[model samples]
Target chain A: MNAVIVENIIKTYGKKKEVTALNDISFDVSQGELFGIIGPDGAGKTSLFRILTTLLLADSGKAMVDGYDVVKDYKAIRKRVGYMPGRFSLYPDLSVEENLNFFATIFNTSIKENYDLIKHIYVQIEPFKDRKAGKLSGGMKQKLALSCALIHRPSVLFLDEPTTGVDAVSRKEFWEMLKTLKEQGITILVSTPYMDEAGLCDRVALIQNGKILSINTPRGIVDSFSKPLWAVKSSRMLPLLKELLQEDFVEDAYPFGEFHHVVMKDQSDEPLLRQFIEDHNNDSAVLQAARPDIEDCFIALMKN
Target chain B: MRTLKFILRKEFRQIFRDPGILRVILIMPAIQLLILPWAADYEIKNIKLAVVDHDHSEYSRQLINKVTSSGYFILTHYSSSYEQALEEIEKDDADLVLQIPDHFEKDLVRENEARLFMALNAINGTKANLGGAYLRTIIQDYNRQVRTEWIQFPRFSSETQIEITSSNWFNPLMNYKYFMVPGILVILLTMVGSNLAAINIVKEKEIGTIEQINVTPIKKFHFVLGKLLPFWILGLVVLTIGLTIARLAYGIIPAGSFLTIYVFAAVYLLAVLGLGLLISTYSVNQQQAMLLSFFLMMIFILLGGLYTSIDSMPEWAKWITRFNPVSYFIEVMRMVVLKGSSLADIKYHLLKMAGFAVVFNGWAIFSYHKRS
Candidate 1:
């Protein structure tokens, strides 16, 4: 069963409706599936989350959460869904335990009622339950926020950029928590700007500029890249990137970490590319056929 | 109802946790109440007099002695030149000038009438007017005494005097603090109630917590009530502190029962807190809410008749005071504190306050959208 369905949702902001935040967007998530929306800053990920969660209204389309219409049955949707906004939305002055207890009581439940669901995440921050939320480190605050969002045992949870500023270790731990929550049959829809996190999700929708570029499993997206990709690195990285982009056979080149990923127009032009790079400078250079990742697929999709 | 309980708990916990809000709620009222009443005294005294006596006769000296000894005027200059006295006025040294003409005391005995001229530096209108009135009363008393001395026998006198004795009611001593303390108490209550409530919701918005609250299933009425009830109770707490200070520091126990003030305050807080919530709903951030509250408060307090009489205001200004919630509370405070008015005596004001409470809270609830 589809836990969430969005059909051509359009939302615009400003007095004259000049800034189109979401434009003809549509997607769906099945029950118990961990879905992801992968994009960079200002890519309309937050706008889509707000619309689906019923915190915002779409200019011209329809959305449903847990079989309830986001517009007409907002009250029903609100009772069944959990939303944690992109920014830190918990009260800073409240202690961690107090914040959790407050959210739980307001939802007409108690912490002990759902302690088994959040025990793993809650135990990590349990020692600092008395400390104010504002004084907690970035990763700890995110964990506490997730706990508050889950205390009510919501069937569908929406997390917008939950791991944006968290450290590498905490991000991994947060994904692990989501995996456990999914096992208990809670459908989760999380948005993040990190391309590497896309592989962790069951499926991802690549979005940019208020539009979705591609929607599929991370491996499916990578397998769909139809061109030969190469990773070229030399002693001088900046000049190597500039030299590769100047060649007509090199379709696209962008600096990815330590190597410049080069998309070639022809699969048989590798020898010509390697000889041209070796002749450009006296420094030793290495070139290899590299496999496409989600970021490479995203870059390739964005160019089209 | 249970949602409201949890929300109230969170709000109160946040309020008590922040020392800044605690100081504003508790210590601010105490300090403002203690200092404002004594400084806002309206009884004008110490008018400086520059005397240019062209006629230094016994009658003139006697008049100067009488005027100076009245405890209202201080004789700052006693030169015989009128120009020097004018210089004194220009230098801000004297507020009034008394120019006695060349009377010589012969004109009073032979001509039976004498003329005297007075000049006042009317820059401070209240002080100049009161000073002129005081000098005229003293000269008239001297004239009556001189006429009585000339009358040799009481039987032949044809003068008929009607003596009028008047007494001040309610406050016989005409104490300024008695009039000022109640008004100041109302202002302090308003500052604590309205500003804090206005900033509270916007603080949630500024820090992004309001969006989380908005996604919850809690009813709008319950949410607004949860936001309002804590501040409403805190407002009453502030009023109690103000009243205690008025009693202990100023010795101003209300002439009427405390129940009347509390009843009126309970209704008054609803109106003001409703106004604060309305402002928060319209503001996007804490700075905007603070600025809007400050602007409205300045207008309300100035026109609320705290320092000026609403009856004496222009017709247009009087219309504005009718809509001002602060004005109604100030009137009720003064009525119950000074006039010893009962609850029945202020039923009209209570009804007006109840009307404000309905209009403001209703408008606030209507405009506050759960999804926008």
Candidate 2:
């Protein structure tokens, strides 16, 4: 059975003429699989996590987490699932060990029983176990938060932007911790706005504007982008994107860091595009061909 | 139950560990209970006076002697001029003044009428009233003494009078400390309980840590109760300390049973913690939580009748006091401490508190939102 199954989940805020946060949102998480929800800020990732975790209610849909209804079996579901919110939400006054023990005690478990499960992550900061959780550095906080989430040996783990505002080392360590968690047969659903992190997941859903645009394996989604994409950059690169989008053959254009990742429509020959560009006297800029990543898929989906 | 215990342990750790939190909770009540009562007295004792003795007779000197030796009024200065007495009054040092006109004794012996003009400052109304009554009683006694020594016919010592004796109920001595310390416990419990619990949750909201609990398998009620139980227990601990001090320092042991007061404190503390939860649901930050908690404590104490009896208030204000949970506890504390009121006698207070518990806990749960 799937570890989590959500069907046509809809959550709206306010009563009359409410704000529709999640509309007809549906997905499923495979058992022990690492799934990702990729979107920019305000893409309903946190809302979805809250609903599945039973801390929130969806307006007009159903969700079953770990063979229990999200609404009806919330208590049993709570026992088996672990959730880390988009922000670090541990007690600041309590030390690292106290936070862990508090959470474990809340779930009707003890730290000794699940020590093996979180030993890898917990031991790194064991020396500072007595330090207040609030005083810990961002990286240590990330680890401690994850350890608390994992202390119950939960069957399903939900991490909402766990690596949000940390250094590269912490983010990398967090992802590695997720991999270790998945190895122990725990289903993981991690939501992140960082497109690069999408590659680390077994499968990812590219979401924007509170709707899922694509859901597939990383390689599968990247290979499915049938457009010939190119990076166009030159001396006057700032205006190069504006000029390119006004062209008849150019389908979509957006700035991608130092380059504008562009897609062409209805053009078969690559040299013909060069000729068109030459004819248009786009001489102040240089255009080079490139392959599309998840960001390209995201931009294309957003445009469509 | 174990979860509640664990939460309480964690709360005690936070409160004892953080000096700021501990000081905010305990220091205000300590000063109010220990220091303020000693400094504040509704029974006015010392009064600076200006006496204008126009008679200059033996009676005037005798009257001045009686006033000075009474210990209630200190003869600041003897002003020969009324203008000088008026200046002294304007200077604000004298609270009272006595004026005796020329031949004050001759007017009394010939016309069978005598008058002693007394002027008093009324800005400090309660003290002023008390001083006024005391001065009147002293003058009346002096007149009775005059009737005995000067009039020899109707001896003042033989008089028919009624003295309504007041037998103070449980606290026979009417020690202000006994009256105040128990009420102070109620106030301290609320400040500690509500502020601690509200700050705990609000701190999580502030630092973004509550989201961790939000995401866990912990039920919403469990999470809220888990948060509340600790502060509730902490409040009881503070009550225990304050009660111990009341016993040790003031020798004010509860006329009622310790276990009964403890049980009352525990249940009352739950209602208080529920209030904190309700406040937490409304507040977004720790500063707002602290501020709102402070406001509620002020409202509770003022309406709780800890300092002044509420029974004398109008029927409308008295009815409003019914909704105040602290009012009930403070009454119950007083009843138990002074009246030695048993659980059976205080059944109404217990029922009222239980109602408050339900109402406050219900409001807490209702206001506590699972989502925005």
Candidate 3:
């Protein structure tokens, strides 16, 4: 049931032992599934999408999109897959409608033929169809680009960090649009740097340094972490994190937004954690055990 | 074929929508046609002349009068001695020096022939050659005038009369505008289309939309061709307007078929659009694309024979120009408009342009790798 199968893909740059963008990376996306490749900027997510889209040639690997090899059957694969890049790649000078139509025409299809599938999204920007794509708002451009990518009614969709620059509401709407596309039996493989949105994907792959650290359902990945996490906050929170790192019992300490998420090295017991805190001249300092999320699990995996 | 049409349509729409680019394509040619004639004349008008009259005689003064009276030479300095004239020539203040030897009036009547020296600056070889030839002819005519009685012919003997008419080819009067307008039209199209298309495509790369295109189902060729097509059509429209101005406004008529002109224009436009595509493919930003295209266009226009004849360029330069398709098309346009040449007459130039189209398009597609 895997819609996409990337096996041992390696892509390197420069002449003299330059950067290896994707180093023997391997993954699979199931049919009718929403797969997220979660990573920060320059973690080989874009490089993977390009290879799957057949826009790039891999150094040493085999990738199959919808049962077609990305290299040998690229011509066949191009017809069945839609790729939406991280940036707003639609023609800015062309009107919204013109941009959509031009892309549709490239695939030898028309907007009218696939209007129903894109109606929900395209209708939002229908009033500004005559306006140049460059003049459209960020959210409006995202919608138009998605509609154009889906116009050909591809079996699989590759969106390489599609919502990276979008607003919170737009990002929400964009994920909803992907859900709608998913309902149409399209396999959606989207990459993003947003950890919060990682929960929204049916399954997520946490990648870093050109390698996937772990791949599992977002909840399963979080639940599988064995560490005891504690949210520590004080009037002097940053100084507390620096002090906690020096402690023998504390395994890892990283700031997760407002408070620092801490884990102890000894799992058998809390290991005199309360005494270390009480010894400090602290008042109204809150320390409590908290539920770990996907990011916590990713941090644990990256440590190993 | 359908994708090509779509891409072409999109390109045209993009160019037409951007008013700045539209103006660049059309307005530049109109201005060049109207304004260029003033400054781009082959007939030298502003010639700087230095005269050294050793005799300081009336006859020597009359010879100076003849040189200035021709309306070509500009007399700026009157040198008292040959060394002073030599200094004037060496200092770059004078383009040509007129040296009359000592006792020029005594020598002319005494020796039956007196020599006059003209030192021409040959840096700009064309101007120097033409100016030198004109000066020599004018002084020779003055010499004949002085010895009119001595050089008399057999008087009024009834000679056998034969009437012959010589047909002048191309342009009988050799109107410079006729030669200029067609070539200028080609260069204008190239300047605007190549510059605009290149900038537009590279702008997308700079802004991050090129990644979007790469991820899309759109083929690379379609992506590039669609972008190139709009400028191609805009170039054609500008070229048509240029030809109309040539015929109606400037009174330089085309001696060949309009269809032939447009047909050739279609191929030539593709070649130029390919050049633009090639330029954009190498540039990651609009600034670099503009600079590269501008540099390439300068070479194209200069080698195109817009200001001077490519035929008259040096042997090495002429060899280099043979590879420039603009030179061929402009040459063909002139030959067709002036001489009324048929298809066979311009076979070489047409074939050359066709080759350029293939090579340029090939380069355009080949340069579409991951680098830029």
Q: What is the TM-score of chain A alone in each candidate?
A: 0.98, 0.95, 0.97
Stretches of candidate 1 off by over 4 Å are: B102-115, B138-165
> What are the per-residue Cα lDDT tens digits for candidate 1 across B1-372?
778888888889988988998898889888888898888877667899999988899988988898899898999999999999999999999999998888648788788888888998999998888789988988888888888787564774566776577897878889988888888888877776678888998898899998998888888998899989999999999999989999999899999999999999999999999899889989999899889999998999899999889999999999999999999999889889988999999999999999999998999899998778
lDDT of 1 by residue, A31-116 (tens): 99999999989999999999888889999998989999999999988888999898999999999999999989888999999999
lDDT score at residue B225, model 2, on the 0-100 scale:
77
Fnat of every candidate, listed in order: 0.95, 0.75, 0.68
The 10 consecutive residues of candidate 3 chain A with the worst lDDT sum are A267-276
Better of 1 and 3 by DockQ: 1
**lDDT tens digits, residue span B1-372, model 3:** 787887677766766677887677667777888888656767777778999888899889989999999999999789778787777778877788888889898888788878888888887787788889999989977976887655564576355645566876676676677777777777777775677778888887897767655655566777776787667767788887888777776887778877777778888888878888888888878889988987887888888787777778999999878877778888778877887777778777677778888898899898786322
Per TM-score, the best of the predicted structures is 1
Q: Per-prediction TM-score, please?
A: 0.95, 0.86, 0.88
**DockQ ranking, best first:** 1, 2, 3
For A66-142, candidate 2 gives per-residue lDDT tens digits of: 99998888878878888887777788888999999998987789999999999999999999999999899999998
lDDT (10s digit) by residue, model 2, range B176-238: 777777777787777777777887778767887666666555556767877776677667767
TM-scores of chain B, in order: 0.92, 0.88, 0.86
How well docked is model 3, in DockQ terms? 0.47
